[model samples]
Target chain A: MIKLKANGRERVWFYAFLSPWIIGFLAFTIVPMLTSVYYSFYKIHVFNMNVVEPTFVGFKNFKYIFEDRLFLKSIGNTFTYAIIRVPVGIIVSLLVAVLLNRKMPGTKLFRTLIYLPAMIPIVGSTIVWRQLFSNDFSLLNFLIGNIGLGPVKWSSYDNAMGSVLLMSIWCGIGPSMIILLAALQNVPVSQMEAAELDGANAVQKFFHIVVPMLSPTLFYLLITGIIGALQAYAEMSLLQMPGDSTTTMTMVVVQNMYRMDGYGIGYSSAMSWFIFFVVGLITVVFFRVTNKFVYYEG
Target chain B: MLKTENKQKRALPLVRTKKTRKLIGDIVCFAVALILSCILIIPFLWMLICSVQPESSLIFMNPPVWPDPIRLVNYKEVFFEIEMPLLFKNTMIIVVSNMVIGIAASISVAYAFARNRTREKNIFFSVLLATMMLPWVVTLVPQYIIYNKINWLGTMLPLIAPSIGGSAFFIFMFRQFLMAIPKDLDEAALIDGCGRLGILIRILLPQCMPIIATMIIFSFNGSWSDYVGPSIYLTDPDQYTLSIGLSKYLVANSVTPWHRVMAGCVLFSLPMIVVIFTCQKAFTRGIVASGLKV
Candidate 1:
């Protein structure tokens, strides 16, 4: 390896080459992150683009976030959504991964098909899904109708949340499945054979061998999944109707940022920050809990 | 003697049980796999069906799961009504340009991080890693404000220019892939009087095909799907990409037709689908090999 010596002036070129990202991050991401924390304490007016000199209103925004009805509802909605979606998404992917791992005919075609949803842009896919779940003529309602069931108002108040969740799972299954499938491939074939030789049935082998060995990949997926679920706003934005059902808390914050204008901006930032903290905390906790279970062969 | 012979026959069958078990295993696996495949393909099949159906017939009280008479008009309507071709062109420019810039910048920077053992390089690379953990939503407004002030908001500058530095995740990916490559090639090139740039371009670049292909597809897919950036930056309707254009269609009115939206989606997603199918293995391997730490 021909290593370059980091002499006094050579450091300048190194710094220069790295300037694009460093400057951008500091100015855009870092500064904004810090400012958001700062602004969470004060009121912000989107119209004026001023923070109202940040009157030292400590925890008021946070307090309001907890007390507000929509905010509270959103918190409940978000938690329920994440809790259900994360596991379902993981399970669906795992199932797909396992099936694809088998020496079956058309495995290649199945793999390609599984990855199709990820290739579709989020907005476009959401649009497609929205139409499929449309109240008047959704593909879903059509399918349901065939079974002699009433067409559910999928995008309406009660059904809308479920619709969004379904959409998320559909779009998310592909990438997670792809990653898990790759991980499955990395599992040693010898382990399976050894179990078989030891008189282990397929069920016993899966539980005793496959599941334990696959835990690390599973842990990784969980961490990434939580991070993703917390930041999920695309489907909500696309599926949200004019009146109400689509109004999850994240959407509320974004709507405040876009439509509600000014009074709620500070509060919204605080709420989103709370989400960030919660997500980060959940991820750390997951790692802590699953660390013991994660098996590393090497 | 007859009883002894019968006992021997039973023992022989028991000893040959592995072959029977193998046959059962294959049959079971095939049966289970077919069911799983059907579940996975349902959505895509629905999408195909929806894309071809006429708008009027799209939402019947008891609509057919499959299109009875395909309407080619939905595709035509998407092109004419939504100006999908223009959006495709617009998105392609951003996607292609950004991919080139991102790849160039990432390869060089990743090479430095993976191979160059300089103090400054280490710190700089660490900074890059740290940035990846920070959420982009935090900085989105600031970036938009900066771009707006710089008079690059409506143009593709804000969308394209920032990619020249490459993404943190992509940089990390390339670095990992580069790390796995043998260092002796670089040593040999150095002995031949090849400069660092020449070694990178002629030697490293060729061997880095899979990673490069991954980067290209990823960048294309990311930029193509990017809605938030374009929705925020591009105020002009005519400048909308497929993402923004599709969003406009969906959010326009309560009575948006399902068939047209599906057709538009199918049309918009063709590029990515085509690219992914063509380089499926490379894409999967690139992600798995690069993402996992040794």
Candidate 2:
């Protein structure tokens, strides 16, 4: 009888402790999530007195999204950005991590310097990058001009994505580099010594042993990077890069929802759902494929 | 003795040659590190230089590399011309409230997950993890509509209120940190007539100082830098955060003063840079722990 009462009390405590998250989950997350899905299927109208009546429109919002040229263009831009940014970002960060991992004088200072950019606010950093890439008075162009190259219009449609990618890589490389550096430190020194004894060159040792050991961290970074790239918004908006070519899906969605004419909430909700679906699919596919390659040290 | 001396001399030369090669490698490493560091540092340096220079210098065909008689006038303009003080106050209000509510809720829930063992707990934990994977954009429009309907459209409540529910990422991070604490501590507290909340408050929270600090820094930084959230909800000039306020410099007019914009950027980034430098070890540990283990 005493044991039963104690067990009952424990359950009560567990529930009590979990109450906040449970409430939050229900109100903010679960309800909002369901509402988004529902909104996606409806034509939501806000009356002058701020009354919201969502009428069931079935697949109309989805169909409109499909037909929307801006939406399609944003999707194309987003994909292109992700494809170029993710792999390149991973490689650059990994290389920097390796360089910083070296046991040398001033390595700590160098790491700190490298990570300073990541600490800057995204909006602030984007502003800085915009100035750096400005065509009229670009420091980058000035330096290149000295080398006899013509000035590049970095914020132009042709170079806008590239400039954004460059800034993203600079800001992003820090955390990934830090994580990879930690993973590199965790790699067994004895294994490297043994490889050296067996006459393995530095490149061979790095690729064959170190890379395998660090694959888990690498995989983690890759997944997160993809998700982050897909959600790219602040930089694009802050940079104010010209034309439809620079508009990401998130940017387009935000623009559509916040339009002064009326609430495009339903359509925007539909687009967000589509993005969520794509992200989910990509995550599923990545995990399925990478499970074969990601090494978890025993 | 002579033959032994000869062998020693021969071995010494090989050792010296190997040391030379190692020295060369170190030099190369140093060079690369220096170059990369310069690449990382130059942008901020450039911003600093540009912020102090006259607007005319920026417009010149060959812009002056160094500011002539560095002026503090642009920073003065940023403060006097712009609503910087109001923006700072608004940001602080949002950041402080969010941190307090967020940390309290996350600690409670994470403690429950860490200390309790039940089938439902396991299921809920998985649900929480799944929620982390769901993009914020998925919740963006719906949440906005809900907030708008509730008449929170022009208020900071939209930013501050949701954080009261606890963030999934922070909760997950706290849960991981709490799990690493030995269960024996919680059991001991329980035996001493402490309830679960008592154990969380008396036992776990004190040990979670590092994570708490990390959360504070992250929450502050996030709220400070958040442009999209503020831009979406706050339309009033008086209610704008630093981010939205600073962004105005870009879209203001054709003759936007780059110097003042750079000045705003410097001031905007200063706090975060200071925080990073001061609590760098904690910052790094938090990042590595959250990134790798999660």
Candidate 3:
């Protein structure tokens, strides 16, 4: 190896460049991650908003998760939402991308409209959806009344989960749509043209050429979607009202921490790790499946 | 000559048939896309109406398709009655501070990772990617404990410090952008007696304004919408950002009047929507460019 003339000085600047993240990780992320592992064994109480030195309970917190009814329900809710939302979100977004792929009039306008909702802050969108799903006074009720259907209590047991699922689908489709649109554009026009010349119809061309080319993007979105859906805390927390019949989410931790005035910080920490594990497992599964099918155009 | 004539003769009818088929396809695609886009955008349309209408007009058996007598009172109330101005200032303080640090740190480390070939580089890079998979929620309690021991709780330190450490995601993004740049530029800068820092500050940064802009936008949006961090750390009413403030508005108005609460939410979310619409081209480009590597 050739020695650089400015080797000593270069090292100083390199360390300087690296310090922010290094310092940050040591101070913030790594410290917190390790601390949380410790906290998973302790019981915490919020006395006057000051956390008392957590009582070391050992594996009690982990055991609580298995025993608690709400804890088990939350796990089921999280997985069910992910399983339902991920594939549906992917399929809808992919379909939208395919529709927007062609050079039709006002296509750009439609694309913009499609992507607009992804920009709205989660809390903001949830508030709007709340009003739309209001039992006594909702635009949905009005629309349904016109068709002679009874007004539905959207947040009730019969519909609450489905309503949230629909909202999830609406909010997520935009980003995936844009990604798929880009992927579609990257597909070779020559290949499509050659297929047409060989007397392949539109469906044949799409199924054989477009779908294969779009798989990598589909896979990427699928993994990220799973990760995102697993972390579905914000909308659920916001949508939930006091005394509401619905309960589906990671928001139970936040709700317990904030509203219940009971601080089982250790139990919450255990729950959080469980969510992380599920997400990690899903991500691994996605990688395994996608490795077989995703066509790397690059 | 016969081949050319036969091709032309066949192409003429095919062109006519193709146009007819394409038109039908366009109509079908347009209708489908229009309906889906409407589904996606309905929340936003409702939000705009919620912000402008009177609290009374907002709550009806059948919500009005259009706001009647268009009460512009909510915006006034949000500014005067609610301490939204203070909330905006608080959010800006956190956003600006972190944006500066995140960009500086991410760009520098990204440059190092992109150009340098140290022995530990691969190990460090994989570790960085691995960290991305660790959900923030898992770290929440532990980080809180650490912060508690250090007595940094109830301050913005908990919120801002992690960002200064180059975010794995942003670092990855910047590295990818830097990789796209020609290496000759760095070599030329080095030949002219520019040190790595000098090259980073002088030559490379100037060429990376688009990416810098992208980083700033995402950082701003992230900080702006971030409720979980500040909420966990800052329990003081004065310390709350817009996100926490919006949530509080809902909780407080759970029974009082949802119209006013929605109005506040609409006002709170306006910045995000406006930013997105204006900079969507850059937004999509930035995300796509960053995601290409992942």
Candidate chain B TM-scores, in order: 0.80, 0.78, 0.78
Q: Which pairs, if any, clash in model 1?
A: A137-B59
Q: How many pairs collide in each candidate, listed in order?
A: 1, 0, 3
List model 3 lDDT by residue over B13-116, tens digit each: 87776777788788998888787777667777777676666654445435464666677776767666568988888888898888888888898888887777
Local lDDT at B219 for model 3: 74
Local accuracy by lDDT, each model: 0.68, 0.71, 0.68
Candidate 1 chain B, poorest ten consecutive residues by summed lDDT: B284-293
Against the native complex, each candidate's DockQ, computed on alpha carbons, is 0.24, 0.31, 0.33
Q: How many backbone collisions does model 1 have? A: 1
Give the per-residue lDDT of model 1 (tens digit) for A189-225: 6667778789899779878877776676676667666
Model 2 per-residue lDDT tens digits across residues B1-294: 979955765678777856666787789989988988888776777778878877634634455357777878989898766678888888889988998898889888887887776658888876775575555655665677788778999899988888766877667656655654446667867888987777777776665665665566567677878877998899888898888888876678587787787788788877766654454343222332232331
TM-score of each: 0.72, 0.74, 0.74
i-RMS, every candidate? 5.6, 5.5, 5.6
Clashes by residue pair, model 2: none
Query: Model 2, A57-77: lDDT tens per residue?
Result: 899988887787776777878
Q: What is the TM-score of chain A alone in each candidate?
A: 0.80, 0.83, 0.83
For candidate 2, please provide the TM-score of chain A on its own: 0.83
Docking class of 1: acceptable
DockQ (model 3, Cα):
0.33
